[model samples]
Target: MNASDRTPADLLRSALAADPARPLVTFYDDATGERVELSVATFANWVAKTANLLQGDLAAAPGDRLALLLPAHWQSAVWLLAASSVGVTVEVGGDPADADLVVSGPDTLEAARACSGERVALALRPLGGRFPQPPAGFADYAVEVPGQGDRFAPYAPVDPDAPALAVGGLELTGVQLVGRARADAAELGLAPGSRLLSGRAYDSWDGLSAGLFAPLVAGGSVVLCRNLGELSQEGLDKRVESERVTNTAV
Candidate 1:
């Protein structure tokens, strides 16, 4: 782990500095037969735009709580990093009523309305499509995100000691989050440039580390798979070979 990396966003910047063209997150939805590969540059661009939207359009400030009501998809990963970039505390599957802002998927829009603050909804379609009819009372993330600035600069610097994540009944500061991710990476034997295929949900700390942060801090990549259980053993083996996966967390 890079000793200079004090936050998750720092980890991403270090990855970008290492090799912008390297594949960072490759997402697959077995149920929909969808696959999308994002290089470090591409993923960081998305993170920047989303971060701008979160801070500028949504009026989010450091220490603000955001309820992220999305599944373990690639876009969810993008939102995770975006929130971290701006120092927003992400609550995985958190209660909407208590959040200062909320991001929801199509499946959780109804529940996310409980948030009295700003709300954004994601269609979660292939290529990040928008809702056929934009949901009422919530901005379409795909629609709004495209117009945001490509470069993000948070108005206030992030505090590493401040709370950054809350999930699985555990709350961690930025320092704690990155530190744990590094530990998990070592425990999972992930090496630099390793490709990890993760089939874990994002509702717990284990899933967050394995699916996103661990590989990231390890200078590796993630093949995030949804509904992977539906794949046959042979199919899964073929995928492992095709993606050159070195580790797995399911």
Candidate 2:
């Protein structure tokens, strides 16, 4: 298929086949002094496992809306791709009450409990650890995802024209999402193999585009930083130098 006809999942698959050993995402939590890097193969493995969990265990379907109540962490990125792989619509920071499934971070547990659908809670801890115990009304993602198959196949083929993402009162189909991401990557001067360091939060289009989708569309990699306020100008510069960052979106 041509690039314009490809979905985000297709982009990921291409990246996996083209350069499995290259870093696709490098995440940093400045507040907690944590850093994690995932190669294309590693990230795709996580996506596969999570996709299996969503499709098999959670019974997710193409039109189902998955409320993603998480921040700009690497795991959140994984969930985005997993939902795309199964043609499940991702509602970032959306109201859980209307969702078919809810995936929440530690801080949003109370709000997520209001959703009646299946719930998954993420610790967002270092190494993507599980909660010490399962939350009252939710399954622990880290625990369940590990037992899932390392490879995933959707029950049915994903439609590129299907609604895929909803954020900031805007929704886009899978094809539209990929098209916009490709344009944004070009506008931002992201070439293949570029390393982008981004400190934008994922709640808005600019952040999501810069920190995740653009890099994926451009065949580049992202160094997504959370709690960026904790970094001084010097520290930030040092990170850019150390990480070989070719672009910055702060």
Candidate 3:
């Protein structure tokens, strides 16, 4: 099979084997004013745990919709990894109404459900939001959710053309998104161990699949910016000059 034919599981298995401990994903945490680095192995484990929780605990059915309204933190990465672990397709958006389950920040929960999540709860929130500045009523995900499952179960490989994510009527399925990611990685020359300076937003058109998932599933490091303004002309120049970022799909 061609690179485009590689499944998310295929890509993930490769990344974990190559350098599971290597910094695969980074997030700028607004609450702590710091960068949170998640190693691929640990992230993979979390993904497994999350997939199990969603499947066994939450009783999430295959092909059922999940909404991730998580803050732009490391947990957002967890949601992505977990969703991929299961064959469950996720509909990440500001709206929870479109989703059967919703995971969001303490403050964002109400809006998350109103938009698409059915009966919003705290299970889908980031761990950081719990401690110092927990949103009013929500409990810590660890505290509220209590247990985290061990491993992810096997599911049939999703159809390439099955609808994976949607915006209005526009939809991209698992196989379709992975195909595009591989194409982006190749067309952009994303090599293993390459660092990407991404100034885009996950909610934006390009950032979601291309800036983030494409490089990641391709085995590249992504330096995410919480704000585009932070990647100022000077900052961009410095990152490119100093970090030697091979590509900027932002």
Per-model TM against the reference: 0.99, 0.98, 0.79
**Residue runs of model 3 more than 4 Å from their true location after superposition:** 1-6, 29-32, 115-140, 144-146, 155-161, 167-169, 231-244
Worst 10 residues of 3 by lDDT: 116-125
Maximum-lDDT candidate: 1
| Candidate 2 C-alpha lDDT tens digits along 39-83 | 999999999999999999999999999999999999999999999
lDDT of each: 0.95, 0.93, 0.62
Worst lDDT run of 10 residues, candidate 2, spans 1-10
| Structure candidate 3, residue pairs in collision | 95-115, 95-116, 96-115, 96-116, 96-117, 97-115, 97-116, 97-117, 98-116, 164-173
- Number of clashing pairs per prediction, in order: 0, 0, 10
RMSD (Cα, Å) of candidate 2?
A: 1.1
Better of 2 and 3 by TM-score: 2
- Model 1 global lDDT (CA atoms, 0 to 1): 0.95
Q: On residues 24-127, what C-alpha lDDT tens digit does candidate 1 reach at each position?
A: 99999999999999999999999999999999989999999999999899999999999999999999999999999999999999999999999999999999
Show where candidate 1 strays beyond 4 Å: none
As a whole number from 0 to 100, the lDDT of residue 15 in candidate 1 is: 96
